[model samples]
Target: MRILTKFMLGLMLVLAVACSRTPTRAPSAGPGANPQLGDSRPHSWTSGSPYGQAVHGIDISRWQGNIDWNRVRGSGISFAFIKSTEGGDHVDPNFRRYWYEAAQARIPRGAYHYYYFCRSGFEQAQWFIRSVPREVGSMPPVIDLEWTNSKTCPRRPSPAEVKREASVFMDIVGRHYGQRPIIYTTVDFYRDNRLGDMRAEFWLRSVADHPRVRYPGQRWAFWQYTGTGIVPGIQGDVDLNAFAGSRSDWVRWLNTRLTR
Candidate 1:
């Protein structure tokens, strides 16, 4: 309980600071790939780091504010996943801007929805479908599942129930997008929820170490290596991610796996 509280408080502090530091004017061109900004510690985790030759990317939300997409692309970020909606009604204010800007900058982008435990899965899926447009060349949609920690709707259902809800949500989203939606989850939630058994791609979050060391034999399409990353275009820290293969492998996966 103490640790959770501290984590929540630390996250709140970071969000406050990040929001306050948002840029007001157009962003300027700056450094591209800065190796010093990432986790360069010599270890297995660092070996598979996003800083390696693989295709790198980032995930953003309203907290990121206005971004210079061109600068981000120049910074070796080949793709992006932008938060589009949450629950059944909350649409990210920056989703449209990010979507448009990403397209203009030729960044392969996808939309993600933050799953709400309190809300019905079908309703949330409908909300996401309405919020995000179906476009060619876009990466598969993502469903972010994790603890809500909400007082108003703090319901942690049984494992069976959680799996059922996820199925319904993924099914609906897949039908709408014409692509299998990826699941974005924390290590604890993935283990506790039996997410590996689910027949969907995964985007894992492992900040302290590589997913290979943390998840151990689990395959992931994307690895969110760090939350506090310093990219050129972003004002504050951004979440950095890496594809699971080489540059050619990434392009092939994007071409063959993604649905129009």
Candidate 2:
């Protein structure tokens, strides 16, 4: 019986390997490039590795101080999501500088707000709206929902409450920016909030494995794949992200979905 079982397992493994090697579609111009970014290549981490053909991008806050946007643009970075605000009052000191510099370098840039569980979502949304200017060619706003583990504001609301608040924030921001906002969440937060049902696009955080492997059936507009990414022009580790499609798709999204 044991010998037979082993033989069957080996056969299944062989079949799986054979199936994996089966040809699918022709290589994209930027095969594995982020479909949304319109590049058909894999990300910096996955290119030439086991995971190939994804476009690459990065996210930054004040922690990555004094970035040289010109060098970053030259580093094959397709886009950036800059941290704009948090809670109801705090704005990242570098938000203005990063936003302007990224534009000057002609890098497509967007702003994200870090949600504070302790505050009302409306208050936070107002803060974000006041801080981030509605500009042409800017990607839709992103609401980053996660556990801060902070001592002062550590309230974990019920899933219903989380959803309600998130909806309120997204709706207001969406109206202001004239684009449907993207929701960025950690795996735990997503599961806790039951975010699968939300209508907005998602930006999922998964570092150890691909979003497909970890997230299963969930569709994400952006994948925040790593927080320890080393990029030129940035002094230290930075968070990296990938759009869901190719560069052309990215352009289409900008044209059709990103404006009033």
How do all models score by TM-score? 0.82, 0.80
**Which portions of model 1 show Cα errors greater than 4 Å?**
1-48
Model-by-model lDDT, in order?
0.76, 0.74
Expressed as tens digits, the lDDT of each residue in 1-260 for candidate 2 is 44334433543453354345633553344322322222222244342221233346889999999998878766657678999999998999999988878776767678999999888889989999999988756778999999888898889999999889988999999989889888999988887777899998888897666777767789988888667666778886788777787544655554565444
RMSD of each: 12.5, 15.4
Pull out the clashing pairs in model 1. Answer: none
Q: Give candidate 2's whole-model lDDT.
A: 0.74
